[model samples]
Target: MTPIGNLKPTIKIYDTTLRDGTQGEGVSLSADDKVKIALRLDKMGFHYIEGGWPGSNPKDMEFFDRIKKHQLKNAVITAFGSTCRPGVEPGQDANLKCLLDSGVKLATIFGKSWDFHVTKALNTTLEENLRMVEESVAFLKGNGLRVFFDAEHFFDGFKANEEYALAVLRAAVLGGAEAVILCDTNGGSMPFEIQQAVEQVAAELPGVELGIHAHNDSEMAVANSIMAVQAGVTQVQGTVNGLGERCGNANLCSIVPNLALKLGYTTIPRDNLSFLTELSRFVYEITNLNPVANQPFVGESAFAHKGGIHVSALMKEPGTYEHMDPASVGNVRRVLMSELSGLSNLLYKYKGLNLDKTSPEGRKVLEQLKKMEHKGYQFEAAEGSLELMLRKAMNGYREPFQLQSMRLILEVREQQPIHSEAVIKMRVGEEIVHTAAEGNGPVNALDNALRKALETIYPEVAALRLLDYKVRVLEEKAGTEAQVRVLIETGNGKETWGTVGVSTNIIEASWQALADSMAYGLLGEK
Candidate 1:
């Protein structure tokens, strides 16, 4: 086995979620949310987390005030801001002073690396810009703070004026910066360019620690960060799920696993690796953002095999189709049963269900699965429901409860004095129950009524709620009479599961999926 770490080489993970991630369009996290996320990041072992620009926003300032009370074991919170203004002294600049008073042990300051930004944006000469970088860093360091100088637009600046770019880094070094971070502000540099530039800087500043800060405009932030590491950079800056301005920054979610598992770089403890996928999902949930299905390594589809040939090969040897065991990254290899499934795929899925694959009943169950999949049933997203259905098809599988019939009545009143109402009658097992509810919409009313009727016998079912519901029209030619497919995601306190239903009526489709979701949860329960 490869040694976990060589004396724990300090590969720092600098998270900028609160600072840069909030810059993404449609993302604005409150101070309370930022503090909660910061606590989680600290627990996950991020060495440094950039909380926010303290003086930039009232909310950020409040975050700093509130976060000071909590004790973070493994992380140091860093305050972020731009260097002092063109002509102002470092001690007099409000932004510089904000960093000093923020009570943070570390501070990161961004200075102009591109000559155009310096002369045009700041309206200052290149030499003055270098002076600002040097003086601001020295002032922060003099205040007993560990300073990191972010060379914004470094790659573009280097290509424009190599001498000036090197000079900016030299100024920070002379000013006592602990690390010189190269920023691809525009996020347009390719991996080759990033590698070359980083290598040159590392050579020039042999004693200084090098860091990489990249954005994903080219969908290459993760690639560029890895390239920088390969080029001898010691630190990586990123946000979880790549949440940041524009296309976003490099995703630490991807970078951590890539470095630890693939490149053999040491950072997080090996046992903690299993938490990678869980943490990725947790961040997405807290952010109220949908996790990308195809995101490398941790995504739901990252290790899922669908095609018949691929599934057949995977059954014999997973290495035939998979790069590595997905469990290494806290994900499991999945055989998705679909129209593309073959006998081997069916056998593997059957084995997963703990049924004898060679039995006659198992063969019948496999045939039924293929037949249902032909009718638009998808097992990949509704694994729980699929497992329940498989058990029902087996010889000795017993169901917890049976649905006899259900009827829904909706009454809409046009008169101002009258109120609309929805009533449901459901026969669960042998008990018949009736309930009435009012909701903003027909689906909500139906869902409420159904739950009310089932709540008596199965109080545990009340904990489930619909997280997402999607509808698709299967046949436009049928117009208003067309078949509809309903996909419903139901989550209890512990876990979430998805189920799908297809029928001519939209209400019926929803009801079918809702019933499947409930049945899946009740499966194997005594």
Candidate 2:
């Protein structure tokens, strides 16, 4: 085996989330969003942030101009682009000129390293392609910007024509490129191929810095990246949450932890690793993408356990089921309660309630849990509702408000829109309040009326807002008469909680979920 001791102890993290990440389908960000994300990445200690291709669009150019106004503490903002065109000089090429004008200290430009791309894609001669790569780096370096050359398709090119691939990197180094990044552009290379190619490049290039940029088409991007690192790469270029074209780029979320925790390589500051999960979720939210619950390291279900034997073993010794402490990556271990749960799951879940598993009250709560789940209640997501049930059972909890009466009215006329209104009466302490509100739908009307009635007595309820509302048909075969389960996600700015209700009547089910959502939010205040 090649000696692993020669590998760089400190790896630099280069984030292209604002550029390559936006190439992923359905991922879009405003210049403001890019600046916000850059600030966060800088605060989190990323070494470099690739803003975008300033030559491609007005938005990216605007991003470059906007980002200059802010002071980033750690990361150097990088502008990305392609090398000079087939026949154009680096100083005259529009793309290269755009990079020069992007007002960033660093610039990364990708040039086709594969001989086939030069002959077919660019319809240019091999010598011209090599000149473009070299001259582009020279021009940028001469202009006071630090330059990094991306050898696009380097791995595949190396496999096809090893000599020419190495020559391309040699040209970049000769042009004073700070780093030559090897790219698996097609994302189809195996880990062993990556390691061998990267190692060969390191040997041939001697003291020149090397970086790795792997895509995830074959689901091997993360593996390929790690292999390259072992083969001698100091800089790792990736997008947060692995967002990129096609399948995606290598996920820094997974790569950083794997390097720091497993391989003993230092990437970001050790303390910054705990912000990984928060950063992952923030990206998903900004891009309007649903988070992958089971995604490794930073996902919601990454540390959740529900199996009885697993929970028993986990409670005894966390290492029996966990690889590392969840807190290490800013995540918490969750003991999920479900039909798959045993007494061990219950005891672990209800430990805060201070109830003995053998106690009558505990047994009753457990049976109620089972019965509710049998009726299509899913507590895993709606832990807020479960907490209310447990509190009522243990402490005789009373709700802040009790609904006395409700009325709904809907109207639809020819050539007019449908209108919905809700009237509600509720008791808060010794006061009986009445309120009416109109909305676009019955659920919205009810929510508005409820909020209007409770805000006077419990003004904190005004801060609560709906984040997500989902309905699942428990009995699909019953069609129109099916029992539907409604899950409502609510938040009070700081954090969010979920509540669920199931019934045959859709309206009743929605009411149940809505009321539980309100109840859960108020519970935090008391």
Q: Identify the leading candidate in terms of TM-score.
A: 2
Which lDDT tens digits does candidate 1 get at residues 413-484? 676433435576667666777778766567777777777777787787778878989998888898998888
TM-score of each predicted structure versus truth: 0.88, 0.90
Clashing pairs in 2: none
lDDT of each: 0.84, 0.90
On lDDT, the leading prediction is 2
lDDT of 1 at 184: 96
Worst 10 residues of 2 by lDDT: 1-10
- Tell me the tens digit of each residue's lDDT in model 2 across 1-526: 1213545479999999999999999999999999889999998999999999999999999999998888888899999999999889988999988998898889999998899988999999999998999998999999999999999999989988999989999889989999999999999999999988988898898899999999999999999999999899999999999999999999999999999887878789988999999999998988889998998999999999988889989988999999988888998899898777777887888787777657666667668888999999998898888878778777667788888998999999788888999999999867999899999899999999989988888888888999999999999899999999999999999889999999998788888889889998997574
**lDDT of model number 1:** 0.84
- Residue 445, model 1, lDDT: 70
Q: Candidate 1: list runs displaced more than 4 Å.
A: 1-9, 350-371, 397-408, 416-468, 476-478, 490-496
